[model samples]
Target: MEFKLEEFTLGPSIDTLKKCKKADLVVIAESFDVDVPVNINKQGLMELLIDKLTEKGLFKEPAPAVEAELGALAGTPAPLQALPTQTGMSAEELKLTLRIREVEVRNRELEVEAMHLRLKAIEMERGAAVAASPSATQSPSQSPHDSFDVSRHIALVPPFRESEVDSYFNAFERIAATLKWPKNVWSLLLQCKLVGKAQEVCTSLSIEDSLKYDVIKATVLRAYQLVPEAYRQKFRKCEKTATQTYGEFAREKGALFDKWCQACKVETFDGLRELLLMEEFKNQLPDKIVIYLNEQKVVTIADAAVLADEFTLTHVSVFSSPVRREPVSTDRRVRSPNGARRNVTASASARETRECFYCHEQGHLIGACPTLKRKGQIKQTKTPAPINLIQIQPLSDKSTKVVESKKAQIDSVFRPFISDGSCSIVGNEKSVPITILRDTGAMQSLIRGSVLPFSAQSYCGTDVLVWGVKMSVIRAPLHLVQIRSQFVSGEFQIAVRPELP
Candidate 1:
């Protein structure tokens, strides 16, 4: 790419040597039109030419027929909206478009580099010319108007970008990658960069009329969000720290908000006046009075005189307000106006069965349940869940042992891991044994990742909508023979693998 320096020292505005020699004599009063050729210093000449030909405003090519462009070039059906809205785009087309976009990005980058080099060359040329000029002052010059002194590195800036958001992101990514950020955090940072670039380009291309700083703000938020998640230790470390700071700020804001009531200069402030008449408001503040409406407790400012259309002191103290209860007519301190004590009033009517600690039901403990008692059912002793297990919830550190033994009684069932070297699994239709791995790292389950066939019903459901297109599910039952079991030695259950399950 040829990088031209418009308005350069040698640009079209370059004054002939005659003009400078004539004009350099302290602007002598000239007769009529100047017969002498005017000479421009390299700096002034470059500036004038650049100002004329350089980008005044971004120009975008006329919007293409988006449908034809996408469908023909990208090989994806274009949605009604230019932005991607549906999954009509096949995976192949998506990959191709991504590649094309990546290439386009590189090309634009070269263009930017070329422009930068042009600017640098123009600057260097002016510097050389100024040094060579004999009339130039030998004394050192200082820019009295410039307040800011620049460093070798440009990164000292805070709200750095006056244009081009990608500058910030590239710098951010460069820093983060150099530090070797954790995988999750790196992913988030990269995504933020991508979105920032998208927004930046959208504005440059005039696709969006307004490109707010929301992109940068969101990137900062996502960067912070990924921190605690990636570095778990900091989650605990900063929890209390942030909480304390927040509390202090909230308290200050709360105090300031209250001052607004007293400063009310309005002549007739009925709400604040009424609120001040209330006993609670008189003692505390205008916002402590509590009332209930539609099962929700509402607090308002008690200083009725300061009540206004915008804010309510009514809800100020709602959090600490007591629930209003109906007055008790009967003396029921000993009983519930019947025979039982106030605490035990609901019981002693019917033979209420005690709940089982094991089964969590009144009828039976897990030990007596058919699931565990069945002859063929494999029973498992109570065990604390393993940290690296299928269950998604965070595990409790505390442990409690069950006093009463509970047994599960169930029809014979089998779960087996099939690992000969590679993987081959077999199962019956109903209750098949399978190692269900839970990956919190993953956003969704890969049902197809499992070798087992999905149930026909599952395939037909809305959940199986493939790429937003409805697809049918296939299901069937099969005996799992190759499965291995940790629960039972040399034992396996006939697992089921539906065609679509």
Candidate 2:
């Protein structure tokens, strides 16, 4: 749409109309920024504008060729024949088709990739049947894992989904890395054998012997759990048998441990002896020859609790009883049929030599080392500021010199206070502190009191009233009755009822 801008000057009236026609008016059409009102019938304004434009001869007039084209558009070309390709088959159209083909090819590729990923996931779940061979290259069909008839493989653990296995494998891989074992756990194929090897490996590791033992123990247990059910019992039994008590086998090997214990230089060798008595340690023992020669009584719960609170020996819990499951009588009764008499070694070859933390170690507690101790070396001693100390004087000491002067002030302040004689004071081993009331005005003396021991308040009514109040037989006459403080805790007395004034 094109526009022209027009400017005009208007005359005032009919008299100036003649001049308006003769006036110089610049007229040009200009485009106006207008949006047609939507959701309303603005077609009426358009119709009126069209008529105006037609009267002004500014409406577009159809050329003969345009009229012919419009007539042809009304009916000439068949729908199929009028398709885009009918226009001489342009290269742009061919390019669009090729682009569509590319999209289809990409979709097919994605489908294939999706299948491959799916298969990989299945392998991870069921434990990937990886084709690892001594040869540089091996076919997937000939893979050791594939040849591993999963049916033949013992089911050590319950079956899990692909995703679950994937998650487990991820964690397994991480632990395997730190333990620095070969990355591929083909041992998983030989689950029981793998666990057995794990125990050996952990035992063999030179670094952090205790920690290594724990790792190997944990790893072996975990691996055992993953073995097929057929292999599990056999594996456990064999593994456990392999880990048989030292008392059963390796008698000669026991000698070395005994020698080592001697060098440890334990104070009494009592603690070391008790350690040998442990079933687990015995099972792992070098031999039966190393039975505890002299053992001390094992620590009790109280002892273990103290140990835990003071140190980080978390293997034992103080709160629970130390479990000593004595192997049943059957094992003991099943002795050698030959009935050969065994000679008791005359004495232990142990001599206290090297210092262990438990024995001669200085400056450090058992299980704690100097390297681990945190240091805060700056030490300063400062005298403590005085505290607000208050001391009570004996009730007998009327002239007690109070360390704090406020005591004298308090005594003077309470001097005028009158008593209604309704309270009592009681004492255990100590006498009750008394404040004497001075009301010397009346002929009858007034006494106000509460029971010395609140607990004996009932007794004041019963025991005291019956017996009458007595202070070492210096009984005051039937005096004013103070229901509150009648009992002198030191004396057994009955309350004296006095006549009301």
Q: For residues 1-501, could you state the per-residue lDDT of candidate 2 as single tens digits?
A: 121121111101122222321111111111111233334233443443345445643333333433234324332221221322234647787566555544543554464455456646767866534434334366555634454444443343233233243233435445545645432233442233333344455455454443332354445544434322222223223321222454654553454444334333334656555443432332432232112211322233334334334443442242122334532221112222233332221111111222335545553333334433432222332222211111222243444344234345655555455222223333333344434344334222322223233333323322221211231221222221223333222232323223211
| lDDT measured at residue 216 in model 2 versus the true structure, 0 to 100 | 45
**Model 2: lowest-lDDT 10 consecutive positions:** 22-31
Q: Report the C-alpha lDDT of model 1 over 1-501, residue by residue, as the tens digit.
A: 222222111111223222443233212112111233367564554344334333421121212343335334333443343443445777787667656654543554464466567657878999999888843654455332133322322233223343434245557656646755433343323333344434344334331222333444444434444221222223222332211455775665554334334223213566455433442332332222222220132224422324421134455332222324432222213222223343212221111344555546664434345544664354442222112122111112243122011111111231131111112332343323333433334322222224544443223222211111133332323222343334333322222322222
* TM-score of each model, in listed order: 0.17, 0.13
Model 1: ten consecutive residues of lowest lDDT: 402-411
Q: After superposition, how far is residue 374 of candidate 2 from its true place, in Å?
A: 44
Q: What is the lDDT of residue 399 in candidate 2?
A: 43
Model 1: residues with Cα > 4 Å off, grouped in runs? 1-220, 223-317, 320-501
The most accurate candidate by TM-score is 1
Best by lDDT: 1
